[model samples]
Target chain A: MRLLKIIIKNYKLLDDNFSLEFIPKGRKNIEDKEFELNQIDDNLYTFATMAVIGKNASGKTTTLEALAIAYDILSNFKIKHSLNEIKNNNKTISLELYFYYNKYLYYYKTDLGYEPINDFVSFKNEELYNCFYYKSYSNDIFNLDKYSKIINNTVLPDDTSIIYTILNKITMRGLYYWSDFELSYDIDKIIEIYKTLDTNMLSVVVNLLDEHIKDIKRENNNKFMILYNDNTQEVKTKKELFSMLSSGTTKGLFLYIQIITAMLSGADVLVDEIEIHFQRTLIDNIINLFKDKSINKYHSTLIFSTHYPELLDLTSRTDNIIICKQNKKRIIVENMYDYNLRSDSIKSKKLYENYFNTAINYETLMNLKKELMQEIK
Target chain B: MKYLIMCEGPNEKAVVNLLLDNNLLIFNRNDLLGLDIYHARQLVPYLVNLINSYNCSNLKIIRIGDKFTDKLKIPESIKHIIDYKQILKCHTHPELEILLIIDKNLFDKFNKEKSKIKAKDFAKKHISLNGHLYDNTTQFWNDYFKNNIKNLVNDIKKCKKIGKNKKEEIYLADLLKK
Candidate 1:
């Protein structure tokens, strides 16, 4: 399943109507410089990176937050916390996420705001299937809604969401949604399919972990690598994913491996601040992997936010850019792909400059270096 | 050795104009950025890099920011840039200082507001720069407190905390004193 487009309305300064039309239907701009924009279908999300830029207090972060919340509304079935109880539950926060799976359009919308207006998943096909929305709360799936920048437009059907509904039933382990949520998903159905994956892609992840463990044990003799928590079942299982290694060395190496793992999982991956806790060079490496879409294995989608300006040289087009800026009262946010920019020239620097401007504090910079030089020599 | 002297605002402009009028300092307004709007902290890196980049050992850069501290913070990336010495937050109220101490006729010329010459002359008689002296740096309000220069300077120093936030109107005062 691939997200084709997203609509943000009255949520943050995205209060205005905005849509990121990834799959351009009936639109012809072959000159769009971006290969993703030239696609004819209304469902394929070909763009690998989404860079957000804006002045201070701009709706940049808010825009991503709204989309994350939208997925949370659909994926989780039961939640003690209502949509409004979540952060920034606007009186009418609604989203129409368009997903395109194998050339078919599926939409998932939720009125997490007020009055619960028409929150349903629908397809235009002759068969109308509406299994309850895929929610993030009160479900077994852990959807990191705020940080995930996914297109909800083309969400897959509930049955289609599980790798195999009937196969994974006998086994308790495989890909499960967030454990804290009470997911009614057929755990038994997915377990049988889990057996198909242990050696192929799963073993590769284990090798990466094993290699990391060897590297760590070679460097540091007795330090505990895989720290287990008795109170948390998920932690115990996830610790196996960690090699016997120091957190810092394992962190950057582990993250890139995780990116590969996510790609192998055949699921939409949402990573916020892909630049965080990683070296700039390592970030470039991860981004390079996503950019190579022709070699994509699992039919996965990658949506991420970053603040590194050196990142600009790595992107394909400004269409993948989303800017969120603050207005006098609210955050002004819109997707760069759909912004109807008058001239292409004014926008080329918009995305990176947005990141650069926030980080450009000259006064503190001067004193810090001045103090550091004194300490250095 | 080329030295740059920066003013906080337009009053600093006027005060420096007056100080130049009294033949005190040797610099001009064009030496600073217009509208006093460029960031105060960013100036540090530019200053630090300028000397080496241009291959000049005697290069200098100076700045005066009026409360830009509340919004712009200096970045930490260029922490080793050691190009120029900074004399920041220097002028107390360079403009108002001109008004408090400079001759009254010079103050009216740059005040931007107009009043009768007779009224201006009457105000001039009440204030004099002859006996004024700043115990450390003269206060902008010393004219009202002192019969001698020390009280005037002390009073001016007193206004720094209160009036430092205000734009200096000293250039106008210098014009009025003229």
Candidate 2:
């Protein structure tokens, strides 16, 4: 099911009064400064560019990790047990996800046992991060077990996207860009979205790799591995992420994976430290993966955090972006678009700082005006 | 009549061009730019973007050499490639297709002596390629493409993996030398 919306109550390392809103393109704005989840709808930004800006340890990684972990557990729980049992079905965690698949509304809540103890808190600790599905109040309006919207199978695997299941076209496309390298997946699960190729385009890609992959696999079974010095050495399946690639290479390929692999196979990624060790120009190159049209639409929505303000030009309204700032006692978030009051593509964040955070991005600086004047003159 | 294709090695590109030219598929100086294929991990995505940008509707993608079927543990969907298959499939090159020409001998080599080419030996061979790839990456593209001599094409109707994307990537570079 497509996760159109999610509302978080009292959670660890998060704002007690925090609720992140995902407003879909053309959907009514359901997000405000207040935190509440009364009516989740089709407009929530499930599949769009979502930027979470915050100070170091401002919960940017935590927020993403929580969501990633939740989804990872849920997708795996239906079949294989997770590495951590206690973490798998925790009773004290509270989270709720509101999503839509095939234009049908669905809500999944997990009572990870955060309920009775804290009188100040709601009722229980519940979570449903990777949990996305479609539900019909009337039951006659739509069917969750099987869908007819997308040409593919209606019933989706537990780990796939609820949106892909309902639409039966594409599913759980976790396009993750990392700001830090600490978080990433161990192995990639490839999926296909039956799209046509661009002729020489596929060959261009294959030309570069066809020979190398052959050599690597020829020496061994067709597995992903690393060739050490003189003897043979086999790496774990997910060697690319952990391998010692340059920051730019890692970032670039990760973005490429988010794009081509998204096209070749219907796989989503969980990237970490997207901006780490990357030059400004490299960072610019990496974001263009989203702009490319050949990518799978469902798998193209990326969820990552950044410390760079110049990267602001990559996104449009604040809806696609968020700023994580630390207030006196809690982490605060403000929309990059709404905070600036401008709806156009801007390098506003770059003007704010060599690094961009919401606090500095939205606020105007005197030096930038002087710089603008110098350029104008 | 202008089209460009990138391959990982001179031998791989030459094998395809030679076969194409021999079969009456005329290639001119302005018609294509042959890029020596490098790493599968990096090559595919870059070319896809280039194709999307140029807006070319008819382009021939010929990747040739050896089929290291053993190591190519790719999913069946991407396995076993054909010449110009990509160009044909995308309708970008409606009549065009993506063909991967590989050495038939290496298939047996990988099958027979796979253990001989220890992972470390394979890595060394990869590093030996550092000069070419590093020079290309560090140097400008125009200069890189210029200094690199065009590979000679010959006849190779017996090449293997003639219709797969994943297996096509394993073209045998040293096969011709052998």
Candidate 3:
């Protein structure tokens, strides 16, 4: 299943509406550009790469966290551990996600209210069909006609989501969402995927780095050894290299493994602060890989948040870059495609500069700096 | 009929929408496109590229902005662009048609009297044409579309064939002076 769009509302600094769109639509002037484009249908096309740009605390990370939380809710069939802690007071924290599973579109919306009591409400639609509809703590009111005719009138407690119970029955192994982490926890899985992939392709990626990683082999006791270019007899454990290698090398390794795992699993990946601890050139190469259709043959969608302007510069399509900004008391999220811009004349760098330096955003930065100073005192 | 009108910001976008609503400007389906850029400097390179992309003599590019003010700062990235008309009038692509519209009091920034200012001087100048100079762009839009739809239509009619010849610039200059 490929994730398309996510709408997050009233969560943390994201008190207002924040949405991310992975697909580009309604453009009559699409030409062959540098980036690889995936055809959704006759007219709609989307970029595999997505980058989020914003000032600090402007809800860049919050947007990714919302997706991670939604994924957790779908994967685990339960509420996230910190959902209550982050939800706005007395307001409904809602999340709406659209995904393409098989050849059908699935839309899922959830509303968690914190009024008299914390309650969960959900509505899901498969294409034109209603999959699941549940509200409040009602008994046996779960509607699943459009979802599955065979499972009608199933009694689900308010605490349990209808989708959660039926998710196992559905084809959900293809969904893969990752939160940005320094340590690569799925090292074993990464090694498995790495072993199956073409050795030449692995060499191409490994050679891109200065470390010149000849290969990564899994050893005993959850430790992996990296073979370097020295060729003489130098093998370093992953733990030993953690202290010797630059932060960029470590991040590049994790990013490579994450990309390989996502592609092999045919799952959408959500990463926050992707440009963190990575060199500019390495980040550019990673973006190029995402843009290359052959490399991402499975069309694994990538949604990442970053503050790096160079990363934004690498983006060619308007829909590929999502902008997050803090308004009066709310966060407004918009993509290049939202403007309905038809020409390549509207470059990403210009838009990034215009957004970051606009008077409203400038004032936001100034006020934020003042608050930081006050806290320091 | 194929034209692009890039507005400075949201207020100008409202002005364009108002013009379209009252039939001040005529469009054939997707023939018209509008963009809202925060800085006039940001529009320069885009205008340059548009001029080169579609070399059609019938293609018109209209860029509307507020009256050029003395205090406004231009970013260094587009410092070479110099004047707004510089983008409209590309040396390599003189056939590139463009209509540069500014608000009233355009002469105020240049320290020139409105009546004494000749459109020919502006033809050589690269300054941004001002929209409603004295009033804000939104108020000017309201006053024009709400009160004088006929005159707005006439100005737009004159604007349609504007970049085809230099005479339209003088005509527009005289009309804006009013």
Cα lDDT tens digits for candidate 2, A130-243 = 223334332222233442222333444333333332333423344445454332441232211102334344334322332222112212222344444354656544354235
Instruction: Please provide, for model 2 over B8-124, each residue's C-alpha lDDT reduced to its tens digit, 9 standing for 90 to 100.
Output: 334333433443443323454445532222222112323333444344555555433233222212222123332244421111110011111111123343335445763223322
lDDT string, candidate 1, B135-176, tens digits: 223243333333343433343444443343544222212212
> Candidate 3 residues A1-377, lDDT tens each?
55666677777767555776666643423222213356544434556767777777676776677766666555555554435544444455776766554444456666655433554433332122233323221122222233433343666555445555445443222233334443556444445556667766666566665456675555654465666787633456655655655656555655676677667765556777876676655555556556554466767667788766655545445667677777886777767566666554435556554744322466777999999999999
DockQ of each: 0.01, 0.02, 0.02
Binned by DockQ into CAPRI classes (incorrect, acceptable, medium, high), candidate 3 is incorrect
Predicted model 2 interface RMSD: 14.1
DockQ winner between 1 and 3, please give it.
Answer: 3
Give the poorly placed runs of model 2, Cα more than 4 Å off: A25-47, A77-91, A113-218, A221-255, A258-261, A264-270, A279-282, A344-377, B1-178
Best candidate, lDDT: 3
Highest-TM-score candidate: 3
- Residue-level lDDT for A321 in candidate 2: 70
TM-score of 2: 0.44
Per-prediction TM-score? 0.41, 0.44, 0.52
Candidate 1 off by > 4 Å: A10-14, A24-45, A73-92, A113-212, A215-258, A337-377, B1-178
